[model samples]
Target: MSTISAQAALLPTFSEVQKAHRRSDVLILDRHGELIHELRVDKTGRRLEWTKLKDVSPALVKAVLQSEDRRFYEHGGVDWKAVGAALIDRFFGSKTRGASTISMQVAVMVQRGGRPLGHKTFRQKWDQMAAARELEKSWKKDEILEAYLNLVSFRSELQGIAAASRGLFGKEPSGLDLKESCTLAALIRSPNALPAVVGQRAALLAQSLSPGEPGEAYRRTAIDALSRPYRLRPYLALAPQVAKILTAGAGQGELSAQTINSTLDLRLQRFALQSLRQQLDLLQGRHVGNGAVLVVDNATGNILAYVGNSGDSQVDGIVAKRQAGSTLKPFLYGLALEKRLLTTASVLDDTPLHISTERGIYMPHDYDHRPRGPVTVRTALSASLNIPAVRTQLLVGTEPFADRLRRVGFDLRRSAEFYGFSLALGTADVSLKELVNAYRCIARGGIVSPLHLTPGHSGRTLRAMDPKVAYLVSDILSDPGSRSVTFGLDNPLTTRYWTAVKTGTSKDMRDNWCIGFSRRYTVGVWVGNLSGDPMWNVSGVSGAAPVWLEVMNYLHGNVRSAPPPRPRGVVAARVPAGHGEAERGELFLAGTEPPSVPAARPAGEAWHIARIAYPPDGTIIVIDPDIPEPNQRVFFETENEAPGLKWRLNGELLPPGEEGRRWAPRVGRYELALVDNGGKVQDAVSFEVRGQNQ
Candidate 1:
């Protein structure tokens, strides 16, 4: 009755211990089945790998049995005395105590990770304890140890000893010195707060160790630790940032875990973290701080990395909502294009605008608060234009726009107040998770996959946007530059890597953002802080971009690059600048609201590039065999001929072209064009005037 030896009552028979060891012991094989991050992550969060336990120093087991529960061998999952004490504590003490056996604790630690260590009712607790007892009756003690080791969280994402030892101490579980063993064991209680730093806690652990010998017990612990030290590496996934999805993946329903296949590339994840940390170290005032990043396998909707807004603290690494800033443009623009409200070729004034909403009058401008007029959709997107995007959002209709965004995996309702004009500029409260998936819709050519942690929804398909529209938006996104600005260029660059990119800035210079895609993947970066303080002038381009570029450059290394899929549904037109009534003629051109682009009138009704023969950005072309140049209209090529409902040859109209049919061009680059089968007399692509090989 006087159970001084608590662990003694709990010890299972040798056969039982052997069987428990087998059931609880799980060998964690990496993607390659190479033992990497091993764990017993359910019960107490002790990270121990099963494979090497028998070979490694067994003294720790002896010590654990001696220290925590001497009655471990004789009792079931719970000793009635311990349970009663825990019950008494709950009813009388300020803090409750855990009354679990090595097996039950292992179950909790390995399977449950970290959650409250109690049950809602006595019956529920007793039932679970009973199950643990039943399992222990049939299993072995070592099995329980294996389970505990695997489930325990050693500091960060490290689950088993294998991961913890490597991630934290930078050594294997088997390599622990006595001090380290004592340190690690003490950590089982509070990994976040080091015992050395937290005086009282360290004292308690050091006291428990009571190694006996002034230095001998410690030496014994160390020697035993190194008997069979671990060797495998660790797994550190950068985890993708699909906040809502991953939130669910983590399961609010219950702490009970189910296998969740992640898109994380462990190697790339570590590299990204290293890259961002490096960038932060080089910033101004030594102030570069908190940030979140996401990487997606665009085609597969698999989130490769979810680096949350990390700071000096725990790095929570997966969930943080900072103002997205211009990172929201791709959605706005994609919505516009999808709704048929605008085309990549549509023009808008990037100057400030004053509007009276039901709430109040809203005025908007650019990052530098500068005014730019008559910019094309392509330019607006590339430059991360503020005014133009808002106007386009308005044209697309805010509620509809927001609804479309919601459909594509963004939850705007959570931060409706943060929306409005600036919302188009990313004022909404969103974590990297939300934006990553939304942006992924564009990259995935309009498909979306909500993050899933459990076995359910594996490889399941979830549709959020139209593929055609997604493709078009993705095309514009790839250019990063949007071709709105004119520069001295020899020729329009093909995707060089089928990539689309955009940069963003938040109010008060608090955030910088860069989101883009390659044919194979999509990456998003956000740099800012938790306090919502300014980051000086860290615009997306300057602050977040460098990091994004670094990660992307690595992701694409050695991979075959493909061009962004071409978009359809746009045409060519001709009209003088300030000459026509639509598209900002002299009235608006001189200093007023430019006249809106007039609705399509009957064709032959001229609408020109307004300015002749310009190299429009995002121009794509397919070359053809030689064809005789337009009936000798300048010794025309015997090369190719332009054909399409509306394919442009440098703002010039192409002859009616066929579909699903390849077109041979006049040995030059052609603006992949479209025709609005919607109406309009004749919307056609203008034939190219500047004949260049690129």
Candidate 2:
């Protein structure tokens, strides 16, 4: 305890000291400042204001002092009964009570601006006493009481009654009640800073304040514990964090005005939070781990929902920059296609290719490392073939590739040298928000709408590439039947009018992501730990795809995704390559379909089926060629090499088999007949099959 000079004594109110002791006040606000959350963050345990001991709620004040310093009023700015008790103990017995009082606490706290007890000494105590006397003389009794309530320290970081009210009750001073007051009383003893101890302290204080009130004692304990989590007021819990970040950026000024009016909608924020937690949990269960997610409206580029990381505690989140992975493939391809350098139907090799650009020759592989030779560009795009993306980057030029990413909002120039082969693999680092917005450009008809925190505010759109080319890319992404979106690639372009997506993984495997969008909303997610150490086997699909799917499905109006508008450049053609019955009469593009779409039937519920199309072991061939009835004779084509393979649909099995497999009479509720080598029948696999066009 340092001395408060005589000059300091002249300043009795100690307003400077008082102001210094003030902590960060909890702010409450709604989407539009309608009061959604509130809280207080006390950096100091001492906050003092003056209210007369009598003017204050006697029950509350009494509960605190009785629960804390029992001989408070009788002592002259000091608790001597406890002092005598301690002196008798230490000098005569074992003194434990340290001589400190409400007035003396106010003295040292105001004079020294509140310091720890380790510095308590005669000089500090005398200065504190001198200051307390000065404060008491000019200030009313109630003011003294209020000042003590505001300034006294109870326990570790638990100061003044107001702070205690917030730290314990999540409410303001006016809202403090009898139970809350008693709880604060108990806290003054230890403030162990532990909610439970505060509660027990409250109980003990209640016992001292009202010796026989058992109910009050019980209520004190219950009330103290209830205050823990609520200590973080609602707004303090959610949006104030936004304010903290924003305020740091703003010059000294009113933070509330700048923050409350931001474009973020509380409802949408809630939707984003709930959406992330639920889906991420599901993703994590599948060993996918954590990531960041951001959703924006294509119509306004307003960030409807922005989740920075998998969780608040995660490191590589919305704010963190990491590898963009294969998700960047579409934008680059879109740039090329927009330039008329390529078309949706153009042939791009999924086969191994060495692109020796000015930088280096890049080699890439498909996700499964499986090479399907000579697939169309449509197939390559649909399947997210790494080789084609690498080739396109080389053809497009690495400088242009980097420029396009920047145009779309990614900051990749810092590491210009790493933009060649690694470009296809998203080696360049970008934030989740940046990648999501880049993809949002495709969803918005090739319009690049930069995002903002405030809605009414708008930004200039840069025509980084042509609409036709971007549309071509999206057209491919939105087509499930496109050459690239294959059956093996779980993420297929949807025609339900709602979806298109791509995922990425950061370098060394620390971060995995899934970024997708529809006509209305775009979402991005990243999952990884803080240490930059990639979780084992975590990839874009394995880690982020499931969560992305869940959230996308939710945001897609809880319905299937719809395809993009068909570009005129893409026209249905009856090609000369197809002749007679030997030549199939299926719709084919002039060149080739975009690789992003997997060949599949029209997007609808019936096609997904009840089961067996879930990759069945046997194929179904109609036995009667002329059959038109629902109950046509269908034979099971069980490849002889697939023996011991069982066939089942919808739970009903076929006739018993010699070894373990059998056939069914109908398509619905069919299960394969099974018998093991030990003469024991294996359990059936149920599935459903429908009409050819279904």
TM-score of each: 0.55, 0.61
lDDT of 1 by residue, 195-240 (tens): 3342333334445656333544444443343333434342422332
Q: Among these predicted structures, which one has the highest lDDT?
A: 2
**How far does residue 679 in candidate 2 sit from its true spot (Å)?**
41
Model 2: how far residue 81 lies from native, Å? 23
Models, CA RMSD each? 13.8, 12.4
Question: lDDT per residue, candidate 2, 254-303, as tens digits?
Answer: 23232244455566566666666676576564454455567677778776
List candidate 1 segments past 4 Å from native. Answer: 1-16, 22-47, 50-54, 57-261, 284-286, 315-318, 358-360, 414-418, 453-464, 480-496, 567-694
Worst 10 residues of 1 by lDDT: 584-593
For model 2, what is the alpha-carbon lDDT of residue 168?
A: 57
